[model samples]
Target: MSYERHFEYPLSASSRLTGSLALGDLETGQRCYREGRLSVDGGRSLPISLTHSPATERLMYGGEVECIEHLRTSLREMGVELPGSGGRWLPGPLLLGSERTRVTQAGVLDCMRSPAFEEALANRQEGEVVVLPVLREGMKYGLQEAVCDVLGAHCDEVVVDAHHVPDESVPYLGRRMELSVFKDADLTLAQREKVKVAILGDSVASGTVIIGLIEVIKQRFPNVERIELVAPLAAVYGLARIAAFGNEAVPLRAHVFESLLNALPPEYYFSPFFPEEEMHMAKRAYSNYRDWWGVDKAGKPIAETACAGYGWSEAFFNPRKQIAMIDEQLRERHGMGLAEVLGRY
Candidate 1:
């Protein structure tokens, strides 16, 4: 029996990759590549013609072609864009750059869109300083790291928000932190005992970095009991809770952190931007989770009355336990796993 198949964007444009067309029938258990206009199949010579679009990267069948359902299914499963029932093609998301760009392509495209930024990048030279005035707070460090990696040139200095803070402040902060971590002389007894990890960024990609760090910590320091992760924006609340409830209490345990874990909508897990719609959805989800948990705005677990007290930060310190708790809550409420969620990022 003969089967019909529709292909979209079937041709390869770049010489770096080779594309092939496979044809076959199931019963004969034979397959062949279309090498010429005429091919001998099942003791009969058949004429075939194939056309391709260089601009659109789409393919069109010009003559009668025979295939099998298995081949069509396999192509579809391999992420080949194929035409649907009405002969309409379904396309995937448009990626920004070539294979060489890979992870840094997004940063490159973002830079290119702004003419001023592109000009600045083009004019930059080794051992020179670059100042970024209006870059987002969370994206500054990551963007600098990515640009430096992609360009293969290092700037003597990169400054962020020079108007508000001194030029030395940002670099000093990073260097001080690095020295405190790597230099043995700078570590105090208490600091050595407590491992403090901070993921200070606003994007979901930052959150995935947090997840990967937690996994690495679990692998490298299995016995190190005290591990703290500081979320910069939420640190004030965490510290308040610690101060109010004392050292033994777990911070953001009842509602705040729980709400964060539960409020994350499925789509926002891997999305680059956190827009207003997602923010509203997250607020609603957080409220729902708080209501379900009988927690009030003040971090109190009260079913009827609103209680006033701060939450602690012990949860941030115990990463393994916190990850386990998050996984449990997500599985119980959303039927999702932490690994699955992080995989999207």
Candidate 2:
């Protein structure tokens, strides 16, 4: 069966696939592709060349298959390895990209222009990696569908991005939109004492998340003394609590990371780009690193969220979107490398 879906924004081929699972319809896109006949909307979505925002190229990352690989590595580290007898069944047949029938005409074109998309289309990359910020109706245009046409050009191993909704968009449109869905797992990992650790910046160690991890630590290392903690702030506190505790000390390892997560979940993931209409309507734009441009002094136009409205003008959306991806990848890779390095201790 083929999956029939709709999007408020224009989508790239890769992103369409990501959104497909959520669409929860028949996989018509696949069936149509096999039958060699599909009917889809015909439209062209333009790529942004230069605009008010910083210019950066967007890349697609992650997939169910990749998730499985990552999960395997994680499980293996936890001491569970699949046997050969388990066969391919343990790892299901992954979809290289969303089936073409799922995409509209313009989505196909955007996918063609993407190097990652092209590589996947040409059978160069492993497990279906594609590039995006795909133009859809609400966010991108028809870039999702184009990916469908291009996938066949590449080897069958390709994976599609398949996202329907625009990623969360904030005024700064940075990493702030990514949610930390695995905070519990993160605490568990930290509990293993497998990695050396360092804490940076100002943060609290008494937040709910921190308290939870501290309990875990207490259970694991009951007699560890004088936990050496280093931080800019003597103690971190919420706005309400900051005044009460002028200076305080808490176990460093237990609360630091958890506090950081509570302070910022969106900063950990990619922010979806909003449509021009939505962008213009925003009150302000926010980024994980810093605030973006704001409204004019006199306020030629004001958006709802003052911080977001003035901060996220449409001009910078494309550029900021691209730059965010590059920066995020570097951060992810670096942090992962750092984690592995620390784990060696």
Candidate 3:
């Protein structure tokens, strides 16, 4: 039972997280990852690869990859030449793939050929910024890479756009991974009763991680009920671009906060940030903050306390401090392996 049929496939699938979303085959499994896009419905047909027998023929019929190539041809035809020594491509919309096409690495390459896209790129003067939304670990990584290459070709000094990383990785940097949940464990009674949990960061990655944890916890603690996400929902990548390009005059942070208030249901209220809220509420509930390395064992309070002093008083003047703070926070809070902390609760 999918919540919404059309919006379901390219989403944070529950079955895959639980290891039940399989067709029980090997070649099909490879196809799921290797093939750019099997269907527009976000790789729903990918399970075929998991279930395919040894004799399963590779049906490379005019699938997602083909559509991506078409998008690339369209971009080139529209005159948005991605500048480079030779021609390489941006990965497609791996995260945003719908039923119409599995927007893979090649598909994003073709998007460059689109007339609307070219028009978007053409206006970039020396001091302008281009905001690109891409997947961290999947095919969309190519899109980020390609966009950077083109920006370098066109701009006088192209500064790469990066978002907040919970790893030792820098801010504005992008990480990559396949679409799958990395952990599965039951939650304790306290965790299940967490009526208010804050999802601090951004990205579809955050959504997947948060939802996966919720599902696991719910399964593990069936007796308890009512788990909630506390933070206002704002895409970190989008916020980063608005911050960088819109500059101080626009008050982007306040704007995003307002949008978040609007998007969410009326019951939720804005807190300082999820990390801060975790520090305040960790005593009452067993909360967690997740990142690329993996989920941590410490309570949300410990994580927030560790990151409290990060960032400079004046970020514009002390950008290096900002980066170092980011580095420190990631190193300190992330990198912990899963633990049996649930038993303590």
Better of 2 and 3 by lDDT: 3
TM-score winner between 1 and 3, please give it.
1
Q: Which predicted model would earn the best TM-score?
A: 1
lDDT of 1 by residue, 56-154 (tens): 111000111123233234334433332433222211111111211232223222322232223334544443322121113223224445346644564
| Model 3 C-alpha lDDT per residue in residues 238-303, reported as the tens digit of each score | 222222222121111110111110111121111112332211112121122212112344434333
Model 1 vs. true fold: TM: 0.21
How accurate locally is residue 173 in candidate 2, as Cα lDDT from 0 to 100? 19
For each candidate in turn, the TM-score is 0.21, 0.18, 0.20
* Model 1, residue pairs in steric clash: 227-317, 228-317, 241-311, 251-312, 251-313
Cα lDDT tens digits, model 2, 236-342, are 11211221211223223211100011111222122222222211111122221112212224432111111111111121233233223332332353332212321
Model 2, residue 345: C-alpha shift (Å) = 47
